[model samples]
Target chain A: MDPYPPSNELGATLGRIRGLVLTQETAQHAVDLLAQVAQETMPNASGAGVSLIHEAQRTSVGATDALVRTADDLQYDLGEGPCLTAWATRSPVMIEDTTTDQRFSRWSGAAAEAGVRSCFSVPLLRGRDSLGAMKVYSTVPGAFDEADRARLTSLSVAASALLGHVQTSETSTRISSELRESLRSRDLVGIAKGILMQREGLTEAEALAALTARARSTGIPFGQLTADIVNGHGASGRRGAP
Target chain B: MIGFPHAEEQRALINAAVVESGFTVGEVWLHYFSLSGEVDEYEVEAYLTGLMPLPSLECDLLALAVNELIDDLPPRRRAPFSDELIRSHAGSGDAE
Candidate 1:
């Protein structure tokens, strides 16, 4: 019989573990599918793009065509565009005509040159956090109306819910690095405990207590102290007392 | 649940220290996992909250993880005496 009762916390922990196993490729695939859906949702759009941004950097981008990719690239490269503004402001951004729009002059000029005359971007939001942005680009001005805007906004809400459980590249990298450092420190403590046990003829508990005592009394950090012990440069001469 | 002497008290103290040290359950679980503690993060959270029991050895390892994290916290600011401040600043130029 299982002793532990099932709870929401357990479900969340399992979800996180599942997220860790899912790779960046899976996230890319999901975004690519979302981008296609966004394009199909708006027939008048020339192309569509979905971007997953982390810390102002594009971690992944899914676009329907070369034009979509180029237009999205210009936004990140110029560091100021409708999509980025939408992500930052946690709202929808509409550029009626890139040729005449005053906002994001550099981005608009470049995007317009690349054949993007109008754009509508909506932030993919999960609760208080903005996951990224989804947008559609059109060659003609005023392509997206209030109805299209509403449709894209609802699409982003669904996309955000799906993407929220997916781990970004940056997050997985940080988690693995932290896990590695923690394992190394834990290994050192184990080796140091073995040394104390062999030399002091103490039980496992006693050895751990001794290590903790030494760390407290000498004001040495536990990891550094254990490292010294394992390196044979600590507590070698004075070992009679338990 | 496996019964261990003083398990509840130990769990309570560990939970208190974890709260005071401002470490999250995920953080504590990471360290405890590194130390070869076998319980999953969810179960560890349960143990810390006294909603469940953990084996004595695992409990000790969790305690060790919390204590180590507490030790790593930055020391609190101390008000220095006038003479101590002067001597510290006075010695900075030639101490090396």
Candidate 2:
């Protein structure tokens, strides 16, 4: 059943979703918009969520409500559900009636008890790697039909591309931040070493060893201990008795 | 034991044993990397398995190796001991 609006209206919805993907200043905003659009456009969708799968961890963001978050969290804990299957297979999985679905029996039974009678999970893929899944839930049994699944799949293609770009951008930003932190730590340690060298006339290794011994004795992180030394407080710069 | 409930606890006990034995952190790293040629977990695990029923004489060595490897980790990535196992096994041969 084609529950969505006529061709021109559906075209407008698709355009609006595409516009959101292009114009949102943050990936978080784009994902929230994606979930909102899924809930608004899909037939009988009570809520929607976006779930990202990374190395050994699964995080679902932009859930429309607590119920949606709970459903996604259940899938993350159990490691099985339409969302995970969709991500693994790089295809969509629809549960027309959660009560009768046997593939993810534990999750399905629990979801039904939570007033979710139907689900549709669409994979967000970028080439071979699956970035995540978009899941929509409905309170009515047999809520989603083939047309609803098709619409979600089409929307997910654009979403996947945008999410892939967002992930890459975020990763680059993190790497840059980490590089800057590493350089700062190095400079702090260098300054501390110079202080010890001038005060105690110690070699580089001896100065480093003295700092490390004090750090271990005081139970302070090596970086923080060095910062304390550079700031001239707490730890005395005088050489300890051998 | 494969079923040990606390991984970080085991690491802490081993680290203490190594430092108590007077081996420098750098020496431990050198010895461990010399044997394995890399700091791969599976390789370390395999090496540790070969030392099953870890002898008292070698316990500190093993502990040193593990501590040095863990010390190289980023601060946020380090998982130190946080269980009562260390207290229960203090100064006991079973800790080795």
Candidate 3:
């Protein structure tokens, strides 16, 4: 039997960590570029925005103008808007006229007051997962045509393929915690090895070997076993089994 | 790869246990690294696959890492006896 079978979870986790390391700056750059693409695709759009959301919270955002920023921020702040709905539903959302729209009443009212009369939002979907959403805002009602919608949808597909590999802040936080735990466990093992070395007059290799032997015999987890040794509950002086 | 007496046997036994324990090479290597096992993850993978050989000491450490991870795995759910369940909830709010 192959001792080390292929581990998809480990590979994916490592890939995410590698992505985080490689794309901390690039992720923001990519979003900014995608927002520019959205604006370029629809020249009539007053402004454009792109957001990478995690668990209903925006992790990264890019906007073509202040109007776009305001419109996108209001969605997160009010917890309802075209972009969020597109992301949640994993589909496109169009507001021909925010003033006449009743779906997201609070958002539409506020958006209209903020000078956003129309919007088109498309979810950035990669396979079964929705990464976030991209949107274009227009100051005039019914500004976008069917062709414009189709163009934006195509852009979203390309954007999703790129952004899907980018790591979010959430992943960085998780990696740090995992590293901290690994360090803590390593420290305990070091201390346990030192104790065994001092008490048994053994070299480092022999000390580790002894610890491994003890763990195997007791069927105890190495971390817990080391903690026991460090805390003076180990079989130090006693040679035979308790 | 060095040839010591029973080196292949030791490697085989360690590989068997690691495979049986269902641990990825990365997980085992991380724990082994924590225990001061001096081998990189790639070499460890190679060693486990029998493509390369590790020193006897490193082999033992790998075995320990696998066994510890196996020990740490959450055990199967066990049905509690009626008396055990009662005793667990018998404290009520007294401790608080």
Candidate 4:
């Protein structure tokens, strides 16, 4: 048998977590549930939250309470704390006693005053890409032991998987939007090309070249110039004959 | 302060701009690089024609990188720098 007795209800907990991940809930709801799972699974954790880092933006989701949110916000505002460190370095960061942790003294002091005496964070990662981080905080100092770390780390795997799914979905939606935009631009340019081809008696490629040249010479964007042509404005009017 | 230290992150911004600007990635790259003095118009044309055309997204990313590099240059130098880019394009006659 495994030497470490199950600290929480592993089987039931995993089943519920799997339902949360696999169900059709919003990404935020899933993230909140994951935080709840962390708080429930780790006996030392008094509160839990997930910090999402996208490009230059940081947001805290599913903080168990206001104190948990405050603890997270302090780290983001200072740009130093276990959660940010975990996201940056893609490793688990443990602050056994925030008062004595000199690495992030300002944030540590703020967090301590907020009643968070200790914390642990693990990055939600997929290969080299970091999805974000999951942080658990406690009012008692030196709250997390190795067993707690092991438990949270395992939970973070589920967190990463769900977060990765959400990331892919968002990316797809963005790409679809971009594709629509590209097509609209293409349509306008194509019509402009046709108009130029017929009016100026030039080949399709030549008409396109002319439009691009005019866009550059006038400092108007290529799409805008083509749009003007479709609307019978600007360069097409200047050309007089076309 | 505006900073894009990671190349991938910079590329992503460039890709968005390329899509939004409706400029082919190659043209944007040539314009950006010409502005930065990193590559001349002829070199960009040569690279584009001799090799398979770069995907438009990739070209935009490279162009964006050049733009960021130029932004980091001294403000007083920016005007003359853009003037040089215009001059270089005038010299090239749409070779790109």
Q: Against the true structure, whose TM-score is highest? A: 1
List TM-scores of chain B, every candidate: 0.86, 0.36, 0.73, 0.33
Please state the CAPRI-style docking class of candidate 2: incorrect
- The worst-scoring run of ten residues by lDDT in candidate 1 chain A lies at A1-10
Cα distance off (Å), candidate 3, residue B94: 63
Error of 3 at B66 (Å): 10
lDDT comparing candidate 4 with the true structure: 0.67
lDDT by residue for model 4 (A1-242), tens: 22433323432232232222223246677678888888999878899998667643473367888899999888778878888889888999999998899989999999998899999999999877887899899999999999999999999998888878765543332233333454466677778879888888889656756765575467665666778888987556335634
* Range of the 10 consecutive residues with the lowest summed lDDT in candidate 2 chain A: A15-24
How close to the true structure is residue B32 of candidate 3, measured as C-alpha lDDT?
83
**For model 2, what is the error of residue B88's alpha carbon versus the real structure, in angstroms, after optimal superposition?**
68
> Per-residue lDDT tens digits of candidate 3, residues B1-95?
37888888888887888888788787788778767678878899889888998877788788777777777898979999999867887867445
- Per-residue lDDT tens digits for candidate 2, residues A165-219, read 8754443332333334434665677788778877788886567666666655675
Model 4, which residues run further than 4 Å from truth?
A1-25, A171-242, B1-96
In the range A14-107, model 1's lDDT, one tens digit per residue, is 3374334535687788889999999999988999989988768887899999999999999888999998999999989999999999999999
Residue A128 deviation, candidate 2, in Å? 1.8
Query: Which CAPRI quality tier does the interface of model 4 achieve?
Result: incorrect
lDDT of 2 by residue, B12-38 (tens): 566565556565443454444322222
The parts of candidate 2 lying over 4 Å away from their true place are: A1-25, A171-242, B1-96
Residue A163 error, candidate 2, Å:
0.9
- Judge candidate 2 at residue A155 and give its lDDT: 86
**TM-score ranking, best first:** 1, 3, 4, 2
Provide backbone clash counts, one per model: 0, 0, 0, 0
CAPRI class of candidate 3: acceptable
